[model samples]
Structures are given as structure tokens and as C-alpha cells.
Target: MLLTVKIGKKTEKLKLNRKEKILKILKKLGLNRENVVCKLNGKIVTEEEYVGTKDKLEIIIIVSGD
Candidate 1:
């Protein structure tokens, strides 16, 4: 299974043998789950969400300023 992930101006195709949690994917990409919001197919999803092949995932980084 291949998942399409978009992060900012970069995109990547991740191969997975089976359905996995979004948190795992974030970790694989060296992103902290706490700092990113995972959106699956235009809907907001949590780290526990399971994603499979052909799913479009957007990882939006949350920005904070003083």
C-alpha cells in the first residue's frame, strides 16, 4: 500500500505493508505528532487514525509565536 503525504511544499509517497497509525508515519518522517495536524482526505484525524493505500494525508505544522 502507498500513502500520499503532503507536508508544506514537499510531498512523499510512503509504502506500507498494512494499515498503520498516523503517528507512526509522522515518526518515520521525523515529525513530531504534537507539532502537526494530520488530515486524511480533507478531514481532521488523530494520531490513532489508521490509514491505508491510496489515502491522501496532509501534515500541517502548527506555528506559534510570542
Candidate 2:
């Protein structure tokens, strides 16, 4: 299965198995799941959400400032 992930100005295509969760994919990509907000098909989703084969994912890295 192919999952499309967009992070800021960059976009990535990732290969995931059936029933794969968002958190696992992030780990594979070397991203910190705790610091990123995930959206699936335009809706905000948790890391435990299951990803479909053709799901489009958007990853937003949260930035904090003083």
C-alpha cells in the first residue's frame, strides 16, 4: 500500500502494509510522533488510527515559541 504524506513544503510517498498505524510509519521515517499532528484525508487523526492503502496523510510538525 502507498501512503502519501505531506510535511510543510515537502511531500513523501511511503509504502505501508495493511492495518499499519500512523505512529509506526512516522517511526520508519525517523519522525517524532509526539511532535507532529497527523491528518488523514483532511481530518485530524491520532497516531493509533489505521491507515488505508490509498489514504492521504498530512504531517504537521508542531513548533513552540516563548
Candidate 3:
């Protein structure tokens, strides 16, 4: 299964197993799940959300300002 992940100006295509969680996919990409906001198919989704083969994921990094 291939999932499209778009982060800022960069986009990546990842090969994932069936029913893989968003968190696991982030881990595979070496990204911290806690610092990123995930949106699946234009809707915000939780880390526990399972991604399908044709799903499109938009990842936005959450930044904290002091």
C-alpha cells in the first residue's frame, strides 16, 4: 500500500502495510508524532487512525513559541 504524505513544501510517497496507524507511519519517516498534526483526506485525524492504500495524508508540524 502506498500513502501520500505532504509536509510543508515537501511530499513523500510511503509504502505501508495494510491498516497501518498514522503514528507508525510517522515513525517510519523519522518524525515525532507528538509534534505533527495529521489530516487524512482533508480531515483531521488522530494518531490511531488507520491509513488506507490510496489515502492522502497532510502533515503539519506544530511549533511552540516561547
Which prediction has the highest lDDT against the true structure?
A: 1
Sum up the clashes in candidate 2.
0
Full-model lDDT, candidate 3: 0.87
Residue 20's lDDT within candidate 1 is 88
| lDDT of candidate 2 over 1-66, digit per residue (tens) | 677789866998887668688898889889998799999999999999988777888989998767
Once superposed on the true structure, which residue ranges of model 2 sit more than 4 Å away at CA? none
Query: CA shift at 53, candidate 3, in angstroms?
Result: 1.6
Off by over 4 Å in 3: none
Question: Judged by TM-score, which candidate is best?
Answer: 1
lDDT of 3 by residue, 1-66 (tens): 677889866999988768788888889888898899999999998989988878888989888888
Error of 1 at 56 (Å): 0.9
Q: Could you tell which candidate, 2 or 3, scores higher by lDDT?
A: 3
Superposed model 1: Cα runs more than 4 Å off: none
TM-scores of the candidates are: 0.90, 0.86, 0.86
RMSD for all candidates, in order, please. 1.1, 1.3, 1.4
- Ordered from best to worst lDDT, the candidate numbers read 1, 3, 2
Candidate lDDT (C-alpha), each: 0.90, 0.86, 0.87
How displaced is residue 52 in candidate 3, in Å?
Answer: 1.0
